[model samples]
Target: MDLLVETFFNLAIMREALPLLLRGVLTTLALCAVVIPLGFAGGLVLAVLGTTRSRWKRFLLACWIDFFRAVPPLVLLIFVHSGLPFAGIELTAFAAVAVAFLLNNSAYYAEIVRAGIESIGRGQREAARSTGLTATQTLTWVVLPQAVRNVLPDLLSNTIEVVKLTSIASVVALPELLYAADMARSVTYNASPIVLAAGFYLLLLWPVVRLLSRLEHRIAG
Candidate 1:
């Protein structure tokens, strides 16, 4: 219908918005590149610390993990961006969003890594011990390798989740895909820009989702 074409298939609007959308794509990729490594590294460290016999250490990290997991991402973002300034701790909008995302991802990744490490057989630990490996050596060299292998799919799935969560950064005016689309819509007063943004998101994420699906299947088998 003409209405559908006018609303969604408008070529002029697409041409106008293409550059903004592409810039958003690059910003999003950059955010993900930073988030995945730091977040996962924090989580891995927390998970490893959680394996300790020290109950208090476990309790402290548990509290941190639970707090971040329970807080909604948007709320956390706002708190980091707005609330911290009250305590004389100032952060740029981008830094705040990145920190919030890192906290969120670290909490989830900690749990995933913990579960993976726990799933390793006790016999394997004993075998490592019998080979004259200390507990730390066994954990670092043996158990972690297998655990990381087992959790690869879950980690990739979480990375996909982090990708989607980047959209939340728009609330802070981070100019990611959603923000770019919003700007274009405000200027043009048409929904076509939003449609284009949605298409971009789909194009970016659908392949990752399918690859995740395949990884899940392979892991399961």
Candidate 2:
């Protein structure tokens, strides 16, 4: 028992690792703050364009979405960070992470938004139009509100996934929470830092998980 505790839960090592881990937490939060909004905005634009009647445009948009969705985010990130320099486009680690996550996450958010938009009935749009609202206005006032509400649970769930996915930023040495933990482990030769990182993650995500459950139940009810 002492051996196990020393290996995995040593308080001294955890204390030593705390400051670096805290900095990592802040970086992770900042990365999320930047990427999540960009993804959502990009997705909204794509979803809106998807409503176009032009068949060729739709085909191209669909292709764009599919290509990004099919590519693994880590591969995409590596390419953006490493491969793009060959094309004379060099991005910093943070910028590379932002761009890659934006591409990958936008596709996912687009699908969710599309699903939400489709759930709205044609009649409501027509009703809004008859009230002298332009198509954009109708979408803004009538369609989107209901659509977003309908998909609130899904959006929140996806956002949670995005938060978790930020850990992958560590691959580029962005010094996210996981990276910090790993560094601490290497330095101390103990697993306690990793365990502390897991505890931090659980603290961060557990409330959202409970809220998601409550939302799903409420939506069902």
Query: How much lDDT does candidate 2 score?
Result: 0.94
Residues 47-117, model 1: lDDT tens digits: 99999998998999999999999999999999999899999989987899889998999999999999899
What is the RMSD, in Å, between candidate 1 and the native fold over all Cα?
Answer: 1.4
Off by over 4 Å in 2: none
lDDT of 2 by residue, 67-174 (tens): 999999999999999999999999999999999999999999998998999999999999999989999999889998898899989988999999999999999999
Q: Supply candidate 1's per-residue lDDT for 14.
A: 83
Highest TM-score, which number?
A: 2
Backbone collision tally, model 2: 0
* TM-score, prediction 2: 0.98
| Model 1 lDDT, residue 62, Cα | 96
lDDT of 2 at 117: 96
Among the numbered candidates, top lDDT falls to 2
